[model samples]
Every structure is written in C-alpha cells, then in structure tokens.
Target: MIATTSLQRMIGALAALLAAVGSASAHPHVFAEARLDVVLSADHQSVKALRHLWRFDELFSSTVLMQFDKNSDLKLDDAELKDVADTIFSSLAEYDYFQLVTVDGKDVHMNAPSQVMTNFDNDQLIVLFESEPATPIKLAGTIDFGVYDPTFYTAIDFTEDANMAVEGLPSTCTRKVIRPDPDTAIAQNQKTLTDAFFNDPTGTDMSKIFATKLELTCKP
Candidate 1:
C-alpha cells in the first residue's frame, strides 16, 4: 500500500512539474484591419484634382502610432525632396496598394497640402490630395493593414553549485526549476515584439490591401 501511495505522489509531482514548464512556453494571438475613403472634385478640367482621405483603425492587443514622429530630423536638400516626392507620387500612380486611377480623362496627382493647427493647436500634415480644376473625378481605393504576433521564449536556469540544500530531498534531486507563465510573459513582451516586427518590414503594401468607390459631383 505504501508503494502505491509513493507512486501516486510521484505521478502528481511530475504532472505539476510538466504543467509549470508548459505554462512558461505559451504565445499571444494578434491581428489588424483598416479602412480608407477617397473623394474627387466636380470641376472637370483636363487636370482635374480631388481629395483622398484615409482613416485607419488598428485592431490589436495594443495601439501603435502610424507616424513615428511629427518632427523628423532627417533633413532633405531640394534634390532629395524632389526625389522623395517623385518616388511617392509615382508609387501612388502605379502601385496597387493605392486606390488611384485617372478621373475624367485627367491624370490625378498626389499633392502635399498646407499644414493646419487643430483646436488643440496641434500641427497636422495632410496625407491626401485632389487635383486642380473641376474635373470628373472618381474615387480610387482603400487599404487594409494586418500583422501577426511574434513568439518569445524565456528560460530560467540554476547551476548545480547554486543549488541550496533541501532538508527532505535526496542529492539526486539537485536541479532547481524556475520559469514564468507564458501568458504573463506574452503580455509583458508583446510591445517589444511588435516594435521589432514593424521596424523590420515597415509600411503596409497598398495595392493588394486597398479597395475603391466612386461618385459624381453636381457642382463646379
């Protein structure tokens, strides 16, 4: 009877040990989705222009800033600015990530609007633009953003020399086990993992992730 009792105790101890170990290796799940809207002007000039407004809401375990800094220190010379602008404009024109198309036989171009301060006096940059002259402009597309959570593993190790004497344990049971719960670890480390993920890849691909809608304007 004593032998059976000892075996049951051992089994229970082993189960507990395994459970503790397993708890330290779990991961969190995450996802994201977004919406966009584009509007065009009524004036149907050959070079018609309209406004493109993008509204994005992130659905995830945490909130992430889309713009890293309002005042970027990366200074650009005129050439550099032109290059950047050209690249951005061309990308918007050709890239599938953006919902961009010619409206009223007029080629649409993305333009930087003047900065404006809100009621709170916070300066904000406009990311959308419309072409000049009243042209028959049509709405282009929308973009969706998404990402998955990254996994992290942490282990606690105790050297044999660090082992303290336990009154009841045999010398063979020398190893000290230490670990943290996976959920707790994930909750603690998710921000760091998310930052790294975004840092590596950068912006969402617009073409495959975007859609479009269009309507006509009655006024000039």
Candidate 2:
C-alpha cells in the first residue's frame, strides 16, 4: 500500500530541489519540457480535449523512477506504471496539472484528467495525460492555451514551435507562440519585493509574468 502522506511530500519536493540554480534566484527548482495537442471535435468548431506530454529533467526523473521501480529492476513494468500513474494523478490534483486554457479571452474550467500514463525515454521519465473542458468549447475569435506551473516553482518549457500542435482544425487555422518579457516588471520591484516575489511557495500570480502563451486563430 502507498503511504499517502509520504508520497505527497516526496513528489512535492519536485518544486524545492529538482534543479540546480543560484541562491540569488529562488525560482524554478523543477524543469520540464512539454507538448500540447489540442483536439477539436468533428465539426471543427468545438474543442474536445487536450493531450499533454511532459518529460521531466534528469534529476527529477531519476528520483521518481527509482521510487517506482519495483523488484529492483531499474525499470517499470505494467504494474509499476500503473502505480506511478496513480501517484501522479493523485498528487497533481492539487496543481490542476498546471494547465491553463482559454477561449475568446475567457478562462475555461477543465475536468480532471481522464487518463494518465508513465514511461521512460532516454533515461528520463515522461508523463502523458488527456483532459477536457467542463463542457465542449466552441471556437470563437481566438483561443489561448498553455501548460504551466502557475506558482513558478516548476518551470515548464515548450522547447520549440513544433511542441504546440492542433488536431482536427481546418486549414485556415494558424497558431503562434507569444513569449513575453517580464524582466521590466521583475526588475522594477526586485529590491523591495524580491523576497515575496520568489518565496511564494504557491507561486500565486508569479506565473503571469513568465508563463509562455500559445494563441490560435481560425477563419470564421
């Protein structure tokens, strides 16, 4: 049986010790490369679901894999994979899987992930899951979505343009990555607010200044 509290604490440490950085910067202890697959309904006017893939950094991957490696095989088999998936699903509930989605500038509430799976690739751990909106969302003037750690404790990086994908969209749809520079806001308040800015364990509003945004446009 899994020790629920122990599992939560261990996974929670991902935010405090996954990455090596300077003391001057208290942000981003965990780093992950992620991808987004937006699934549209057959009509091409409604979003049905979102499929996500996240590959964890080496330090974090090694720790998680070791914990889930039953039988000391240094690998996870079917049973082990299910165990890891369950643990992740339970732990991530608190973070909402770090996903933010919007349609026409309005925030969309997502249902809990319907599926979660675990895998190993090139010595790193990968997690995949699919989630849908509370209700299917109709395509409006524009849609915006992203995978992120709102608390800034985890740095989710979408490495390239190809990491963002749209499926079932009409040929007229186009997407773009909008990377904003928040240095000015951070710098202006650094001296007086540095402690509160980086030390907020929950990450609160800090993500607004750093989260990468993906925008989609489709011809009406």
Best by lDDT: 2
TM-score of each: 0.24, 0.80
Say which candidate scores most in TM-score: 2
lDDT of 2 by residue, 1-220 (tens): 3244544434543342323222223467667899988899988888898899998899867777677777988888889888878888887787778788877777889999976888889988788999999999777668888876654656778898778888667777778887767787568656545675567533354565566777888777
Clashing pairs in 2: 151-203
Where does candidate 2 stray beyond 4 Å? 1-25, 184-202
* Candidate 1: stretches off by over 4 Å: 1-48, 60-63, 66-99, 103-107, 110-210, 215-220
Give all candidates' CA lDDT scores.
Answer: 0.27, 0.74
Give, for candidate 1, the lowest lDDT window spanning 10 residues: 116-125
